[model samples]
Target: MKHLTVVDHPLVQHKLSHMRDVQTPSHQFRQLLRETSHLLAYEITRNLKSGTREIDTPMQQMEAPVLTGRRPALVSILRAGNGLLDGVLDLVPMARVGFVGLYRDEETLKPVQYYFKVPEQLDQRQVIVVDPMLATGHSAIATISLLKEAGAKDLRFLCLVAAPDGVAAMQDAHPDVPIVTAALDKGLNENGYIYPGLGDAGDRIFGTD
Candidate 1:
């Protein structure tokens, strides 16, 4: 899939192994997720545009390369997505933060939006959408649709882990948006959960269950 990128960095793979264990505690799980997110962020933004600007260092004045475009927007798919926001923010502290809160409707198995608040100039900057898991893909698709309706142009998706089904669905819906994920697990189970996946990211991250 040209739109997909699975990060195979040794650190990312190693931390993800620990994250999959049922025995990993909530605090430890959250810590590993944050660390992994930081690594993924590094790879996702590696090609960000840069331009030279004059600057005065402690010793001398010279032109140095710096990010040239408008600061990016980091849009977190709420609750679970918040788990990765800390690490991403650590890397891009100046990025505009946005939230899209969606919950699944049990009977319909569709995502319903409860909240959405994004930066004003979404059309002018690159937008990175963050979520811990890409499961059924409905939420991601809906969130991206909402952002586009609100005028977001460039967009990318970041996730801790994704299932093949979710990846397929996302690719079909938004072919131009690239997906950066730590691991691509087997297909989803009958219940729409990724098999061999870190169970219930929201619950695990918050110690809710």
Candidate 2:
């Protein structure tokens, strides 16, 4: 799993357990997702470029580290992805935001792009593509392809839970892009849902269905 990263922090794991419970309400579910996204953002940005700048402290002058280069961009895959986006944005308030709306076709289980928008100069900035679930990977792959065509070079995929099938599909399609996820579950069940996975993230997050 060289391209895969499972965030196993105690706090993340604990929150994830709550999110998986069938009895958890939509409000609580969204809260847990936000809290968990904060942790995931921290892990994903651990290696972000930084530079030192001189600053005057209350006591004396000193040098402090600050993020370098253009602020990183967060591209939400839409609907469900927005859940993670809210939390990431809380941490990276200055990050350029983008949105790519893709819905899965029930018959084909393929991604259909209905909306797509991203910041300019994507090639010059690191981009984190966010979504709550990586089930079949078709949507992730299609979205990444779209980003690449639009000039995004450095990209990473973040998700709350992923199925092995989804991870494998992403690896096959975009091996260069690392995947950061909370849990890599057994695999997808028929109908393309991750097994032992928390139910549909969009419905849970938005109080729909």
Candidate 3:
């Protein structure tokens, strides 16, 4: 993956547009998110390495390409990340699941960690961190830092949307970790929210105010 990837597939864009609409209900928003996530997962996993394995078919024997190495680890950045995680899992059922719980301090716009758990042998497998929004990028940077500390070397970040500031911050903090998002909006608002973003993803998905 490159330093950044924006998935502009029509289906992804269509669903994202609906998700951005305030009129869309929670159930519909959740459905759209799951559908959009599948498309994003396709783009993110496009570069994964593969090896061939001989298998006997009904008519003949042939070598079939299979994903190489251990199953990739999918680490959700808690709460809203679960929305994306659900759909990604539908695509990559074998992926190992993990979570890092962190909530932002509204006053400071910094991440505060409360929970962390991940698969073993993180150093060997590719780790993909999922979160819905990259606003200030504090939570993402902090989450990736912890994953690195846990021995995750090959890591990638996935989100539904991103702000310019957040992307820049993430790149500055963790240049090696590539970011894949549905859309990169203009920038953040005074309150650290992505402008024209789909509002609070967790709240929208869960029907909270």
Candidate 4:
């Protein structure tokens, strides 16, 4: 996988347009995100390794392809990551799930970790970190570092939208992890929000804003 992959599939772009709309309601926004996540999941998991297994069919015995390795781990970056997590889980029903809780400090525009939990054998399984937005990348960088400390080696970062600054920061901090996003928007605002991004993904998803 490349350092960055923008999933530009038609359906993903279409749903993202609605998500970016300020007038979109929480219920509708949540539905769109769930739908869009499926598409993004397709791209992010494209390179997973597969092997063949011999099985008997009604007609004859033949080899059938199946995923070969241990189940991949889906690590959600708390709150907003849950929205994407649900959809991805729908697709990969057997995937292991985990969470890292962090909130940005408004004054310093940095992430502060509050909670962390992840499945065991991280070094043996592929870990994909999910979050809705990558505005400053502070939370993502911090979360990935913790995962590494916990023995996670193979990892990926998935998001709905990303700012150049965030992408660059991730690349600089963790060059080995590939980043997969639905869209890379114009950049960050003065307050560190991605410009034209679906504002406060947590708020929009929960109707708190």
Which parts of model 3 have CA positions greater than 4 angstroms off?
none
Model 2 segments beyond 4 Å from truth? none
Model 4 segments beyond 4 Å from truth?
Answer: none
Give the candidate order by descending lDDT. 2, 3, 4, 1
Q: Mark the 10 consecutive residues where model 3 has the least summed lDDT.
A: 1-10
Give the TM-scores of the predictions, in the order they appear.
0.96, 0.98, 0.98, 0.98
Question: lDDT scores for all predictions?
Answer: 0.92, 0.95, 0.94, 0.94
Model 4 residue 94 distance off true place after TM-score fit, in angstroms = 0.3
Model 3 per-residue lDDT tens digits across residues 1-209: 23999999899999999999999999999999999999999988886768999999999999999999989999999899999999999999999999999999989999999999999999988899999999999999999999999999999999999998999999999999999999999988899999799999999999999
> Where does candidate 1 have its weakest 10-residue lDDT segment?
43-52
**Which residue pairs show backbone clashes in model 2?**
none
lDDT of 1 by residue, 1-209 (tens): 77899999999999999999999999999999999999999978876678999999999999999997889999999899999998999999989999999997877768999999999988888999999899889999999999999999899999999998899999999998999999999878877888899999999999997
